[model samples]
Target: MVTGLTLNLFDFQEKAVMQLLDLTTDSRCKQTIVVKSPTGSGKTIILIGFVDEYLNKVNSNTAIVWLCPGKGDLEEQSRQKMMKVAPHRTTQNLFDALRNGFPSESTTFINWELVTKKGNTAIKDSERKNLYDRIAEAHRSGMDFIVIIDEEHSNNTAKAKDIIDHFSAKNIIRVSATAVENKRYEFYEIDELDVIDEGLITKALYVNEGIEDNVEITDDYEYLLDLADAKRKAIAARYQEVLPEGKVIRPLALIQFPNGQPETIRAVERKLESMGYTYDNGMVSIWMSEDKRDLPENLTENDAQPVFLLMKQAISTGWDCPRAKILVKLREGMSEQFEIQTIGRIRRMPEAKHYDDDLLDFCSVYTFDEKYKAGLLATMDKAYETRRLFLKPKCKTFTLEKEYRDLDFDGLGEREVLNRIYDALVEKYHLTSDKQRNRMILAGNGYVIGDEILGQALHGVFVRTDMVAEATSYYGTRKRVDTHKHGMQLLHSTDAIKTAIGLSTGKVKTILERLFRKGGNPKKKLLALNTAEFYAFVINNEHLLRDEFRKITSGMSQQLGLTLEPKKGVFHIPEQDFFKYDPGVKEEIEYLSNAYQEYTSGYATSLVRSISEQLFEQYCESRDDIEWVYKNGDTGQQYFSIVYLDALRHQWLFYADYIVMKKDGTVWVIETKGGESKGKDKNIDPQIENKFNAFKSYAAKHGLHWGFVRDKDNRLYINNTEFAIDMADDHWKPISLVF
Candidate 1:
């Protein structure tokens, strides 16, 4: 019945649920278990699955108390998800449960603030009596209780901890993305990489390059706003490009102000209005104290009208909006530190796919305070469990090569091959003697064919050689012919071929003999042959063979279908590890020295490193020899990394910048350097030289060309060649000159 639950859970989620259940059920395990899962990791679904499984398996009379932060719409959302999983069970809120006693099969969702408040405002005398009475009744009735704390980090205050301790539940399961450690509980940390690898969230974060080490707010407020606007426009453009036809999605931006003061709110609002953002026009929605706009229950839900949401720390926790791709923080002071909950608001991908564009693949944040930026980066590093820009390579490159050799076809033409096949079939079917036929008949009736009977029947047959070799290799068997005999006996014993032919083995054997005889034609040897004749005459009929063999030997020929053809003797080369080098590489290389003019192509670009790299990209576009030039960070561009060992034997992964493919099927792996260059050294930096060597080695192994280009003073260096070739002066050269 637990398997009947309709929640679509990822592997990690299911594992988390199972772990909680195991700890709860085992008497030796700890009573309190903490599950640490990141935001957007579907913690609610896991909880639902766990609760449903526990109730259905352990005790139907068990009660669950789910505690969430604040009195917001999250309680309702949690209740709805729980009901979907266990419709037959009852779900109620704490306020409702205060009036009605706890039901036998029910879950109660309570706000943490309700019980954590001080004095009479906490639980009224009547409410306290109701809760205690329900607890007493449940204990008397031999019912179990479970308390689940959601976002446990937020409610770690002394009052909250006291409220959790007040509940006399059998088990406590705490869940949070950023869990604070406590000595009273056992902790389980879910790998953040698992979530990112599963494509449940984005892999990296991208911020504006203009943010400096120390920023002045008064001087850069307008510029910060403009940068935020540009980021929003870029996100919107990307959404338009990748969204399905006829479907529209308006990306939202969250602007977190410093505080909720009226003066500050009004000032920010006036500035936004001048920038064409007004609540009257539906361009902006406010969630501050002064202007509490009636927003949708879930802002991430489709059809929400706000393009910009202005707030001051209200929707940071217990809120999810996948369309929120941009964040603009107007920092007033150092009071606001970057927290994991703040980053989680925009970490989720709306459709769970990055659309292969850097703009869409990353979440951007724009802030004016330098200290706030540093704190945010540090918090992200801790939350994601990553060091500074720890890159995991996502692409691999392979090339195709050819090898020439003489193929041995056994010196046989088509007709001769058919003759050899016929001979092999005759020996395989035991048509050489009557004793062999009797042995096959006995084996078909479930009698084991011993070694002597097998050796006599399969003495001259090589038809089963390949199968015997493969079976012996897989099973580590030395008696190869024993495998063959067992195969033949199993095949003949099944009713598959007999049922299809609707004839007895004696008659089928007679037909097979006439069909496989030396240069024999079925029409001449017997009545005119029909379509079904080959169904039984073919010794290697895969369907009949597999069905028959499976009855005796399990898991044999399960993947092989009904058509089993004889193995040919041709020496054909397989595609694996075959790399092809271009034969016309000399004519395809072009040198441009005098005709270098920057050309702009109407292609969307992002994360450009320098002006020279941009100009190099333009020059690559203008050349006729270049089939396609992929700039780094472009959508659908190939990205790859190579691992090289340093002198100390430490492994380092280096990513290539550009991949250029020529029309004649040649590829160049290029790394562009753009800074003030050391003039004509002809000696690349040792580290860079090591990477170049690694790249060249990988390219040669994969049959791809490799190059290192220096875009300084409008000159290019192919590999380590000493020629200072200009893109403006055009000429042809051999790619081998650099190699």
Candidate 2:
């Protein structure tokens, strides 16, 4: 049994675990299942869940061998994590497992080095009898063995293959972000976009665009180190701005050196000293082959954590730290090719959610080698279906039209609104200051006045129910009726009245009898009061009611979900696009393609796209005839690439873009074109002509308007003709022209 720890697996994590278990247990399922989950997707927790679920189904004890890819630290990390999930089960090395005769219900985490040594020569004869012989004997004795290979890509070598072949296990599971292709294993990939959308990791990778030019003429190592320092400072400042109260986060910059040579290490030390990032000053820590310095302890409680981690390739895999957000690589002796494992170190959000600032919401990589940078981009293009390796603007700014202004609602007076709100509340809740009646009403409607007041009301009600149930226990069929009648009569009794309202017996009795008439159902009346509606009305009118409403709703306002909607009349248009172009956003556009490559202004074309969207939205709001407006990507069903006959009598598929719907039953298909040359060219391109002809045919058949929008020069060409309309100055002109 697993205990003493709470596991909060996200939706994706839970799904991955169930899928893995299904693959492992099916009678006809493959012996090996590959789980290709992205970095920081909690692969360790998924492993634990798999073990737990597997154990529950089997009648006998099963042995699990977790093969990790590194030496002592990786093994230790696996053991600690497994212990948290299943403390009662044994967690040891191969030697211990073999000595114990492959103990049932035990997990042994062995370093790949232990089994992958050359010629199987690493194990001595005496130890081989205990380790290898014991495992082989256990297999022959019908004990089930499950082997899980972590970082399978890095460990999928000849020696590793030998180790797995020797096991001859019942099942094998390989887990990694980047899986090696094998025909024998069943492949399952977790959606990377799903992980990003869940806010489990950072959104995009940001790279320096000018690094190529900088690397050609400058001392590459020194220039790249300076850039790393700048990024570190910028990230630290942003972190401080959004740091939650009572939380300490020391943003870390991970600098990866090629190898742990003495001169290289000394050079990095001198650079750190020059930058005021010395160990004694408490800003730098080193992790290398020869020396390992412990990271600052109590990192969550104190701000003494090192700001910079200088190390070689050792920390690439199996190192988990959320605070490492910046990765700097000085490719001295390292290969020019990019590997995904290196970037995985800095991908996790320290708090599992991005900060409000855009700068802090992304992980950055600074490298001076142009060849290496290009290699990284190529790797990213292949690994992620959507291109995420790109240079992002440091800041985005939007231009606003003078006509875009706030709506006026001052004509509707506060007193008039307050009176309507009060009436609505009274109709729903039966406005009353009486303590006992309000308590009953609040209870029936799921609202609490106060814990003290609610406790007293509950105790009084329980006592009355107990008395009624006891008195009517003999009247089997009439029990419910008898209880209601007795409970109501008890409310009018002298002791009940005194306990409830501290009033005189006669006065309290008179009030109770008046409130509950002879033919009126007390329960039915309480049930009709709608607390949610009443609370909403009170909250919306709080500005008018001021202190009076605050006193009435005091502690329960927040619980009722009655947050006042922003004043509807005063509309404030955001100065920027809601879907801002962050390097972290998953959507991709091919900027290097011919259509976009000619526009060398760098983000100017993207800015034009943003402006086009804004103009459309503004045009929609200003016109009363416009019913609905939708961007091309808003709905998957909005556009149809349909086959149609062109003017040349050839069949073609029209690629539709944006859609505009008007009040008088008319739909317009708007295709936006970018680039000044495209807009200015007299002769339309064949591709554009084909699409135009198809659009015209479809619109004529369906009775819709087909138009073209040149975003570069803000011109509109309507009715599927070469004749253009100059509406560049006023985007609203389209409403009049199209209609």
Q: How does candidate 1 score on lDDT?
A: 0.54
Candidate lDDT scores, in order, read 0.54, 0.53
Poorly placed runs, candidate 2 (over 4 Å): 1-7, 118-122, 209-217, 293-304, 333-335, 370-739
Best by lDDT: 1
lDDT of 1 by residue, 1-739 (tens): 1343446678887787778878898888778787777777788988988888788887777888899977346777799877776687689998777777567668899887776656736588777767777767777877778999887655555556545555678898988776644444667777766776667676655544344433333323355667777887888887788788877677788888767656556666777788898888777888875666856555666446777888886566677788887777764432244443566777787877556776776776665332222111211112211111111122123222311112321122223323333343344444433444644653464444332211110111111111211221111111222332233333453334444322345544444445423235543131122323222223324344333322222111121222212122221111121111222122333222111111123221222134445555656756677655544432221224565433222234456666666777686767765423445433333446455565666677677776766554555535433223332223212323452
User: What tens digits encode model 2's per-residue C-alpha lDDT throughout 356-376?
Assistant: 566776777665322322111
After best superposition, candidate 1 residue 674: deviation in angstroms? Answer: 56
Off by over 4 Å in 1: 1-6, 119-123, 181-183, 212-220, 294-298, 369-739
Error of 2 at 180 (Å): 4.3
Clash count for candidate 1 is 16
Q: Model 2 RMSD to the real structure?
A: 29.4
